[model samples]
Every structure is written in structure tokens, then in C-alpha cells.
Target: MTGETIGSDSADDNDDTLAAAGEFAVIDRLVAGRTQADAVTLGPGDDAAVVTAADGRTVVSTDMLVQDRHFRLDWSTPHDIGRKAIAQNAADIEAMGGRPTAFVVAFGAPSDTSVSVAASVTDGLWDEARQLGASIAGGDLVSAPLWVISVTVLGDLGGREPVRRSGARAGDTVAVAGELGRSAAGYALLHRGIEGQAGFSELRQRHLTPQPPYGQGACAADAGATAMTDVSDGLLADLGHIATASGVGIDVDRRLLDGDRQAVAEAAAAVGADPWEWVLGGGEDHALAATFPGALPPGWRAVGRVLDGPPTVLVDGGAWAGNAGWQSFD
Candidate 1:
């Protein structure tokens, strides 16, 4: 009972690790003073939270980020990691043409982790959730050897059907709602230990925390998108999924992606890597890539076209012979 309190007003700063603060106190600190969105009828402090799904249907998705695998503590602050976790999960909901309503996070970190650090992470979770007009309804904290953050997001489809990967037809246009290759460019910069340049600094920050094109999924759906997905895996690899599912070929025009390539050209030069590789193969950008039947929606740029062929993703009608994407085992 003589442990350090975990709330924001706690006086003790030193020796304020999770073990020192205890579980219930830390949970209280994470939930304290937090406001839930209107969809969340009941929030933290109960066995479970209650969220409303107005359309009599709910879209749900889950993602897990492990330390060193999905993120690095040395490169990303606890706050950045929290934001990344929420953004990626929210992107999944967006891919389904839904708006995220609530999130339940389950976090595990070493007992020696500082309570202040945990609070910062929670703050980041709340911050990013607010961008989607959502809230963190509830979550769990547990002791582990390394950091593991898992998030489950509940989304509303707004009476629209969820866009499926199998819906892309041969003639549909492939459009993207957000920038690509920045995260990969940032990763290359971080990997090469290159810093100090103002532009490179921006790329590095992007690697730590992604800026997902929020609200575009619904827009794409409203614009008659036939198939949709988020660019979490490299663009080519993710598009390959739609190709495989829809039994169509995707031909990406490199010319159409020049802007993305140019955005990272300088950083690529500094790191001695090809900007095209990152633009085509880099992952974690979380940009929304959808196939539309007609003109693209606002904020979307045409990048490719669905083709009538075998299930494959082609760059300029040829296969790309570079590292195409992230693999959990590799």
C-alpha cells in the first residue's frame, strides 16, 4: 500500500516505474480525466466498455506492435509508439470504409518502465484517437519483458457497405489518398544513422509516427470505390492482395508516382538508396489505396490501374525485383 501513485498529480517522480506504482493505480492514471466520444455509452472503470453502432452493424479490427519489431524505443518515444499503434489500427477501419468509434488497448511493458513514460504513451493514444473523432474506451496493462501494444478499434460504416478487396474490376482506376514512401525514406535515414538535415529530420519523424489520411476511406467509398486497402505493407505488396483477391492484375505507372519519388529523392540520395524502391516497396505509410470506377475522389491521386491479367502487381508492366514488403518472419 506504500507504493507511488500513478495519477498525473502524483508528487513522486523518481522510482515511478510500473512496479513501483502498482496496477490499479496506473490504470486509473491512464483513464483519469479522459473523455470518450459520443458513441461510447460507457467507458473505463467497468468490466467492459459499451459503444454504439448506429447502422446495426460494426466493423472491427485489431493490430499488435512489438518493440524492436514494429518500433524502436531508442528511435521512437513512448508517445510516438502510442500514436503509431492507434494510427495503424485506425487505418484498418478506414480501409473498410468506416469511421473508428472506440479503441481498447492492451499494453505490456517491463515493470521497470516509468509511469511518466506510460502516461505520455496514453496521452498520445488519446491525441491520435481524437483526430478520428474516436476515443479510448478501455484497456489493460500487464508486465512483460518487452513492450507490446495491441489495439482493437470499433468502426461505424455509416450505412455504407464495407469495401472488399475482391471488388476491383479490370478497368477500375487505382488511386491513393495519402503520400507514400516517406516512412521508408525515414527508415532508411534512421538505419543509416543520418540526421541533422532539416528535411531528413522530417523523414525520421515520419518513421516514428505516420500521418494517415483520415476520413478518406469513407470518401473513397462514397465515390464508388470498388476495392480498398491501406498501404501498411509496401504499396505493391498491398495492391497484390487486391489483385489476388479480385483475380485481376494491377499495373502501376511509375510516372504517376513521381511526386512521391521526388519527395524522397534527396533523402534517398543521402542514404544511397533508390527513391523508387521506397515508393514502390516501402511499407507503414498507411495511405489509403483504393480502386475506383470513375474519377477519383477529392484528395486522391491516380497511381495505377486495375488490369485484366493474372493475379500480380506490376510496376510499369514489369515485375519489380526489389524487396517488395515487410514480412513477419523475414
Candidate 2:
């Protein structure tokens, strides 16, 4: 998830600031001309919104982003921040083998911020939601020192059991859906101020807004996924959670991930960094990783195998000595 805080200088005198528009007017602009998903029974304009849970249960998750902490306005636009906020939260639903149905967002920015910027953010939220056949049921706009966004996602399992992170067995194959290392590599490029490369811009955009494999979570579930999670953190760190939960060890073959390394090898070279580190330890790709007992499904490739041993993630049969993933504090 991500948030924003911006300077008022970006807004022209003709623009209506948040304080000038007032909270109600600003919120009206945010929710105007929006369509609700089928799951949403009632949308904004009421005291509360309602969404239907067809399977008799609802899957819910929430995440937040802060200025300078989760995002930098100078690097990303309000629209990018909005898309990222929705994508990351939706990933949590997908990781659990559910379909995202609706989202409720809360945004906080300086009173002097432009309403157009806020509307741009809402446009981003709705555009991304439309891709998954979801809706932005409702949200709140508030005054704050910086841009901060918090999103809550509601999902449906469609009568199937939810896939968790604790069902791996000794012989299960570990597989991943979607490409890896792109976002991390993008971050590296942006951080180092590298530009004008053929592929570096795409990498930087990936860092601004991730592209999670949307429907692969349900496909993995149907294909008999025993355990699952989205790779928001580094691959090794995320799999380590599965290892601990399932009481099994995971061994990844570096050769299996060479393709991902190659994808970012040029950018890594430009920055004088190791592409393998990004492939193994880079996080925020939002890719799906799961353990399956049967043939891998389409769009998923096997990267390793479950082992009968102490719970841990090993690289090429040994421990990894480099950074394993992102840490909120550090």
C-alpha cells in the first residue's frame, strides 16, 4: 500500500484546495460518477456502505502507506499512489484465493492540497479496481500534515476453501506466479538516479505501482495449492513464513530463477549491483508463491521443492548470507 503528501505550489491559484472545497465537497468529487461492483449493495452517499457476501463469509484485509515512509510524492504521482494502494491490498485477497469485490479508502493530506490531485488519486483507485471487476464503495477525506492512505479490501471465496500459508507437505513443489525482481530492480534504479536506459523507466514504474498476478490465486487453489502467500517481502523471507507455519524446509534452485535474474541483469550491471540478490531477497513484486501436490497450473512455474527438515528457507541447499528482504524498521 502507499500514500501521498504534496506541496501546494503545484496547484495554480484557480484550483480549489481541500480547505477551499471543504471536506464534503472534496469527498463528493472523489466519489462522483463511480460505479459499484455487484457485491456492493450500497455505495457512497449514505452514512455507511453495504456489500454482499455470497458464500456466507467475507475475506478482509487492510494496509496503510505514509509519505516518505511508504511513498515519495516527488517520485510518484497521486494517481500512482492510489493505484499502488489498491494493488497491494488486493494482493492480500488474491493470496488467500479470493476475488476482490470492493475497497474502502481513507486519505489524508494537507488542507492546502489541490482537489484535482485528490481526484486524480481517486481515478487511479477506480481504474485499477475496474481491472479486477471490483469497486470503490466509499472513502473518507481528512486533514493531515502529509499524504497518508489506508485501504480496506473485501473479497469473496466463491464457495471454495481459503488457501493459507500452512499446508505445505514434505514432497510438495514450490511454485510462483508472475515475474520476480522487477520492482526491486526498479527501486534500485530510481534510488541510484539511473535514467535513459531502454528498460530502466519500466522498472521505475514497477516500483511506483506493482503488477500483481490478479486471478492466479484462485487458479492455484483449484490446482490443489496446499499453502500460499503473495511475495510482498523478499521471496526467501516470505517462504520462510510458510516454512515456519508448515514445519518444513524449502530449498530453492538458483538455476530455476536464472530467467528472472536475466530479466534485470542489465539494470543490475548499470547500477553495479547483484541481480541475484534482487531475485531472491527483493520484495514488493506481489507475485504469488505456493506449494502444490500436483502438476503446476498455467502461469505458474516450479522453483523449488518442500523438504522434510527444520523449518527454514535455504538457497541452493545452504543458508543465504545477503539481505533477505525489506524491513519496516531499518
lDDT of each: 0.91, 0.91
Off by over 4 Å in 2: 1-13
CA lDDT for candidate 2? 0.91
Best by TM-score: 2
lDDT of each residue in 1-330, candidate 1, tens digit only: 112222335455464788978999999988999888999999999999999999999999999999889998779977898999999999999999999999999998888777888988999999999999999999999988888899999999999999999999999999999989999999999988998579899988888899989999999999999999999989999999999999999999999999999999999999999998899999999999999999998899999999997999998989899978888787
Residue-level lDDT tens digits of model 2 in 262-303: 999999999999998899999888999999999999999999
6 Cα displacement, candidate 2 (Å): 3.8
Q: List, in order, the clash count of every candidate structure.
A: 0, 2
Cα misplacement distance, residue 109 of candidate 1 (Å): 0.8
RMSD of each: 3.4, 2.3
